[model samples]
Target: MLNKLTDAQVKSATAEGQKQRKIADGGGLTLVIRSGSKTWWYRYRFAGKQKTYSIGTYPEVSLKEARAQRDEARRLLSENKDPVMARRTKGIRQQHDAENTFKAVAEDWLQNQETELAAETIRITRRRLENWVYPKLGTLPLTEIDPPAVLKVLRRIEDQGKHETAHRIRQRISQVYRFAISEGRAQWDPAGNLSGVLKTTPTQNRAAIIKPDELAGLLRAIDGYAGQPATCAALQLSPLVFLRPGELRMATWEEIDLDNWMWVVPGRRMKGTKKAKRAGQVPDHKIPLPRQAIEILQPLKQLTGHRDLVFESIKPGRPISDNTINSALRTMGYDSSRMVSHGFRSTASTLLHEMGWQPEIIELQLAHKQRNDVAAVYNRSARIQERTKMMQQWADYLDSLKQGADVVAINRR
Candidate 1:
């Protein structure tokens, strides 16, 4: 077979009046002309069957390029492979690569996980991904991201002395890889084998002041905070209500009953598994508001009462950021090692348990997820009376503490 088509010949070729015309360039390559359009074709046989492979359009797929493509197809045939099937496989792989970028898979995971995960968990996960992972690995295809590439991103976070954050980002990356594998987007979790590769951050209990005198000092400091009044009120209310930072920050007026002295924290805001949240298996948490809580809210009501969120941020229509309370604490000379917003729960729980309150009552107030759903439902109303009493007394004890009363833990049980 000899080459029968030239670049000059191809430029002049046409099927102006005719519907279609074909010119063979030998050994399976052909030029098909349609009225004003031209295309390159490689007609070949594989496994005793004929197949026509479209190389590309005319000018784009020049004669020299078409010959190269035909030669490549011939080489595939010589290797006992079907060029058409081989080409289809390549195309499918390319499509998969395009659709399964690390960021694309992560976004899909987030959307798929929203129903299952608590709102706060979803928010934290998304924020972590957006800040740490996306900038480094987002555009890269999933399969192309090996352990080192993923580790490179984690390393940058670790280098900043954010070992815990680095670990968290690694966990997030691993989660996305797991999702990708489950969805047939990735072959293996590169992050899975790299567990020992990151610095191990020792888990420390949140910083809190359980001692009466120190806690009283913290209380007085909180009372004097001159930032936003809403924040000051939140600082005053956090320990009394026994809500997590997120639950406390996201409080809506609808959830509060000043008259009844209660705040109903919706299940979506409480911590739980994706399945529990998605199925609505996690029930709403009822908190008995102490008199002190009511006192703080009553006056603050005049300010933020018209808003949906009780602790509305300065920015309209949004709750305060998770860091707002912690930042305020920092502003007041308390660092992470000294105390945190979450430590308020720890502090109250410690002092309450030490003050002779039942562990069950404190756990219920803390909204710790119960292992047994049946027992959890049974205990929902188990100790409301005791909890209500404990709350009021807790507020009273704090009031006494703030007055510089060197008080011992009261045995109220």
Candidate 2:
């Protein structure tokens, strides 16, 4: 029995400041109301409950548009569902998606990335996520993330003067976002648009090898180091074998083939390369075992014999601290730039080259692949005899250098 809503009547009611009119045609409905303003709404009974939902302002929605919206709402209601509830459920879902936080995605990214990344890499990635990224943005979902939030996390680390860590964290976050997209967990990469948004800084390279002249000083210094004997031997051998710090620290008695004069670095312990998957053999490295090197190991065997590593730490089975080697170097008057424990490789490479040994032999001794192609395997024997002689001669050369004797190269070719 409601009258049709004419524009003139609608305007006249609004002007008179009357409570707005109600106009209904068939099942369609429109509400005109004023509370310091005129507006429209649709009212109906659903499941025996009355519900009134706004259809926007009267003039903006108009009579025709209001009727259309009313019909759509009723059609949805006829399906034994409440339109308001349906709309509420859709909104809840969108909210959930937008709330997918940084911490949750990062954990998922770390687990799925287990296969693609190296063990050491995985360890570091997880540590960074746990220690730095998680506490900051771990709860925020990616879709709702923006640059300012990301910059805030980065700037916190930067404020601590860990610019390098900050840069790496940003890079790690980007990688996580990429992984999320690939796994169908995310629809877009929020990290993609970040450019010039963060400051770029160069990180200093700290790897160093002691100079040839300084080897004598280092040897003499090791003799004086007040550290544990096992620490001393490991420090001395670091340069001689030039093994990776982890490889050196984790040396197990089971892996040593002293009879063959080879230390077979098992694949699990080695860094990735074609040879890493298969067992890689480090030749006896023919250490004539300097009296100093031998002396340090002899007594230490009785101490760490029960443990796996030749230089097991006081922490029972744990390997020595990553800083143990470098710290020993620093105590010996070498800074990171002067000499790093890893710099032994460069030291050996340079000294062997200076001693007039063939590049092939030195490179082979170094276990460096001459080419990247799979077909380019190292010729295991190109320098077997030469390396044996070179290592002994190199030991003697180090002795002479330590004694401040004029070093003369012996060509054992």
lDDT of each prediction vs. the true structure?
Answer: 0.87, 0.69
lDDT of 1 at 227: 87
Give the alpha carbon lDDT tens digit for every residue of 1-413 in model 2: 44366667666564354555454444546655555556666677887989986767867777677677777787888898787787789788777665556777787777776765666787987898788878877877777677777778888888888877887888888888887788676777665665456666666654665465667777778667788766877886776667778878887766654445555566566556333454343222222333434444556667876678788877878778888989988877888878787788888787788778888777766666546423224354344566667666776677777788655565666
Candidate 1: stretches off by over 4 Å: 1-71, 273-275, 278-280, 302-308, 313-318
TM-score of 1: 0.79
lDDT of 1: 0.87
What is the per-residue lDDT of model 1 for residues 1-413, given as tens digits with 9 covering 90 to 100?
Answer: 74887889999998967899999999999999998799988998887888899999989888999999999999999999988889899999889888988889999999998877766688999998999888988988998988899899888988888889888888888999889888778879989877798889877788988889998898899899998887888888887776888889988999999999988888877777868766777788888888889899999899989888898889989988889899999998999998999998899899888888889988988888789987776676578888889888889989999998876557655
Instruction: Give the Å error, residue 49, model 2.
Output: 13
Please give the lDDT score for candidate 2: 0.69
Give the TM-scores of the predictions, in the order they appear: 0.79, 0.68
The candidate 1 region of ten consecutive residues with least summed lDDT is 404-413
* Best lDDT among the predictions, by candidate number: 1
